[model samples]
Target: MLAIPVLAAVITIAWAADADIYLESIDKKFFNSLNKIESIFKTWFPKFSFSTEYHIENYQINSLNNESYGLLYSGGLDSLSSYIKHKKETLSLISIWGADIPLNKTKFWDKVKYKVTQLAEMDDIKCYFIKTNVREMMNENLLNKTYLEGEDTNWWLSVSHGLILTSLTSLLPIKTLIMPSSMDENEKVPHGSDLFKFMDYRWADSSLIYDCNLSRHEKIKYLLRGNTQYYQFLRVCYTQFQDYNCGMCEKCLRTITGLLIEGIDPNKCNFKVKNGFLDLIKYYLSNNIILLHSEIAAWEDIQNNIPEESSIEFSFGLKNLILMIIIIKRTIKKEYF
Candidate 1:
């Protein structure tokens, strides 16, 4: 259990640096799955592709202790949708401060704690808080300085988050671990979370399931359709600038656009949408200042939700934003994917 997560925390770094992985003992299932997952990533992200040998002293076989569903919850829409989708079987909800809030951000974790506590208490679910510095297990500055070639590159987004977050659940006994899909199945971007499916169905006796059947916008629509009050606890922001969804980041803006497309005021969903915020998005896109790596596919999901004939706020801003994302991808960021 200890060695598996530690290996996950560093495996991508090893792959990127072409360094070999040496482990004392690893679950044979996970080791085998890593090879397949690595191959898939090589096809998805060829720029960082590198092969490495795995030296394991012992390959142990493990089995599930019980039948229970667990989810990697972040109080975000994706996890919220996953929770609602499997709420009947989901007995355990796992949230790690290290993954997003960071170990030292006690204040931020308090906001997360309040929301998750309220959510679990309302749903009669078990919530576990794993506080660690696992996300800080690597020197990200050094990783980027060595690897980033003057473009946007996030260590957590493109490489280390999915496996490391899922592996932390090993500390608890779970039958199946559910990781929220960050993109639609049709999206072709190379994301670290996209590899979760290859790691599915086996890890010792526990299974890792990443569901991509529903797009992000579709998840929002599902949440609305379920008519559950649990959606009130959504926390979609990863930045340190706010208590919840900072409605200006590219992620928050995209999510805000999705919510607006569904006719819900973002303020009702843990985000503060100030006046003229839609114009701000237009300004950034018009000036070619993309707020983040711009998950073009996610933006495309929002685009698809808007009808071609409807000339609403989301329809117009999303139109130009998608164009900018496409232009950036084709001209500037094509080589990375």
Candidate 2:
């Protein structure tokens, strides 16, 4: 039996659920391949270096033989895109709480669970909900600290999220785990990308990273081809976890921007984008909060896709300059005070 131990939510969830994990038939060659791939990905990021102190604990390996398979669905664009692509297949949809969504807040989680379950049932897919306290165990400030101080962009998810997802398969009854790609092949990074997904799932019978072929904007375009009804069910906002979208947060605004660029009405899809939306985009740029790299790329695509004569025009010129001056003044005042 072989197992690679890591700190992950899946381990905690399995312990909480008393999940039986079997590893006697584990493929040693596949496990080594996963480790080697992980090492190669580590080399991509200058700040990241693979730690060699981790060990395989005997207790972490239990026994299970169920052939169930599914994905870690969050009702977001990437996962939803993958869901639509594989809707016809017999698969289970697993949702985890205590990661992005708080574990104890029943008001928000209950609503999300209900909505997700309905979405699954509509497609005749089995839905499983797992609640965990893994986030509570770690210090958020420390977790947010970049691998190399002042050098690397904060990759909070990349550092440990792949292990968490991979661990879920080993601990649960899931044999095959399909994770949606967060970025396209062009902007490949070490964290949460297809490279990480391919390297992390050594224990599963089949572990695949889906949709590396499409960019974030392209995924939205593909998703729009499907029944647009699922658009209303998207829970992209992390600011207000209880609500579907707050419309003001960076995430909500980014999604709204993409949807609008794709000629889709955000309001019709249940996302309300108020007036002065361009000003908001400027504020984001001034604050250095550009959401995701793909988002920036998507914005450029939006500009290119729309005809120049179209009434809906987007420009990031004067507003951003004015906002930057205001922000600089505010920062100087706070520093002096």
Candidate 3:
């Protein structure tokens, strides 16, 4: 396993004062901290260098500025499509991986690593691979009741990445942190919403951090626009490894369903399960009741009209009863597995 030297202590001590102060008081200190991080990166990855011509801009932590664009790249289909779509305006790509997990253990880490390396080779953009001690960070912050809730692991993780990027921005001449989250991801019950909201809320609450922005719908539209080749490389499943996606997972089911709705065949991807199509149908039937209600509510709000019979409501009521019976049976048998 490759590891960067312990620069965390140096960063903590050097930026103690800046970290203590609210976002407003730490411009110079933040810049200094960023310089240190960049220096460490230069030592660790000598081939990588910051762009000489770029210029840095300062702002209140909550303010959105052009210089604030950095992508929380995950090497997934959504992120990859968004990145390719906005390649021209993007300043940098940032990825965070838990040091304990190893790339092979994580579902999409290898794919992401490969794509980022490819993108870095293009010379049009800069990619930063941030290794995080996630367990350590969680442990250190766990005493705080907010962190204990674990309401949004994704957002919390992103904020952790954001902090690193913000520190990097402090050193580099870039503004605007561009994250490619989606509207679907933001919707209730969707994957990683807790984490996304956590990062957004924390950044917004901070008096020191400024100009954080997320491009959800815009990125979606960009991907929807003729990016067929780019779409082929997207990986969304949380299971399976090395050229195959476990289609039964929540992510795989949703991706395939959406593609089908858009008239695309889910089986054509580089990764997929043998029974992906049937799995998607079965999952939809099992989960559709609640999902339909949520979708209907959203659609109703947009249309400003009621459905003739509220199919979602009827379906949910029926499905809830069935699910409850299943849970009861499992509890009775002590066969939770």
Which candidate should be chosen as best, given lDDT against the real structure?
1
* Candidate-wise lDDT, in order: 0.72, 0.58, 0.42
Query: What ranking emerges by TM-score with the best candidate at the front?
Result: 1, 2, 3
lDDT of 1 by residue, 103-219 (tens): 777888888888898989998989988877876678888776775444455677666777788877886878888888755555433566777655453578788788667888998
Q: After superposing candidate 2 on the true structure, give the runs of residues whose Cα lies further than 4 Å from its correct spot.
A: 1-34, 44-68, 143-146, 149-152, 185-189, 197-200, 276-279, 282-295, 307-337
RMSD of 2: 8.2
Off by over 4 Å in 3: 1-69, 99-111, 120-124, 140-173, 184-222, 239-244, 267-269, 273-276, 287-337
Would you list the clashing residue pairs of candidate 2?
Answer: 21-62, 21-63, 22-62, 22-63
- Per-residue error (Å), model 2, residue 67: 4.6
What's the lDDT for residue 220 in model 3? 28
The local distance difference test score of model 1 is 0.72
lDDT (Cα, 0-100) at 310 in candidate 1: 38
Better of 2 and 3 by TM-score: 2
